[model samples]
Target: MKQLLLEIDETTEAKINAAAKTAGLSAQQWLQQIIDEKTVTTWPNAIKALAGTWQDAPFSEELRAAEGQDISREDF
Candidate 1:
């Protein structure tokens, strides 16, 4: 694990402490969680779950099938 040194003002430090307490984690753990959440590379599960949900959605091929014709027939 790498160590990070941050210089924060008193107000920011207090806010971080309060947030960490509320989350039942140490300040370091809260910061680590935030870093992990921000650095994620893939779609979250909630978004991935929406895949293929539109029953009548058009594919890329379908969209190009008839250019200039609007996708009005597309369900969603």
Candidate 2:
């Protein structure tokens, strides 16, 4: 694991401390959670659950057919 140092204004620091207390987490844990939520790129669970939902729709055939096919390229 790596260590990080952050500097914030007194007001912001106070807010963070209050929030961490409210959430029942140590200040370090609360900050880490906030960082993870902002930085992580994985799809949310709700969106992941929607995968393949359109497979049986009426346009599914046309949608798949258009996947890799290309159009004619014209010269300028």
Candidate 3:
């Protein structure tokens, strides 16, 4: 585990503290989780950036059909 120090405005600090309390975590723990999520290099955003220029991609009809397979009464 690494320790870090950050400075933010009172409003932002209060918001983070509130969120941490709501999720039953300490302010430090919640802030660390947020930082980890933002800094993780090999996440979904990185993968999408690497796959550049999808100009010739074909839409999969099978996927389109599968999307509508699960129907519910509320869907109507």
Candidate 4:
């Protein structure tokens, strides 16, 4: 395990302690939990479940037809 040193104002320190107490965790554990929550880059399970929910939506056909068809070329 690695040790990290963090410096904070007294007010911030107090808030961290209070929040940690409220969550029934030590300051270190609370901070670790926060880090874990923030370090995730993938979609949550609920959102992952929605991946193909829109596959058959009415607009999919229109959007597919418009893909890569540029309409902005000059006539000159």
| TM-score of each candidate structure, all chains considered together | 0.65, 0.58, 0.48, 0.61
Candidate 1: what lDDT? 0.92
Tens digit of per-residue lDDT, candidate 3, span 1-76? 7767788999998999899999899998897798898998776875788676566556788548656665557754
- Clash count for candidate 1 is 0
TM-score top scorer: 1
Write model 1 residue lDDT over 1-76, tens digit each, in one string.
Answer: 8888999999999999999999999999999999999999999999999998879867898878767666457577
Order the candidates by lDDT, highest first.
1, 4, 2, 3
Candidate 1 residue runs with Cα over 4 Å from true position:
54-76
- The CA lDDT at 43 in model 3 is 60
Give the Cα-based TM-score of candidate 4 against the true structure. Answer: 0.61
What are the runs in model 2 whose C-alpha is more than 4 Å off?
51-76
In model 1, the clashing pairs are none
The positional error of residue 66 in candidate 2, measured at the CA in angstroms, is: 32
Backbone clash count, each prediction separately: 0, 0, 0, 0
**Model 4 residue 17 distance off true place after TM-score fit, in angstroms:** 0.9
Question: Tens digits of per-residue lDDT for model 2 on 1-76?
Answer: 8988888999999999999999999999999999998998998899999988875756777768858867799999
Q: Give RMSD to native, each candidate.
A: 9.7, 8.6, 13.6, 6.8
lDDT of each: 0.92, 0.90, 0.82, 0.91
The C-alpha stretches of model 3 lying farther than 4 A from their native spots are 43-76
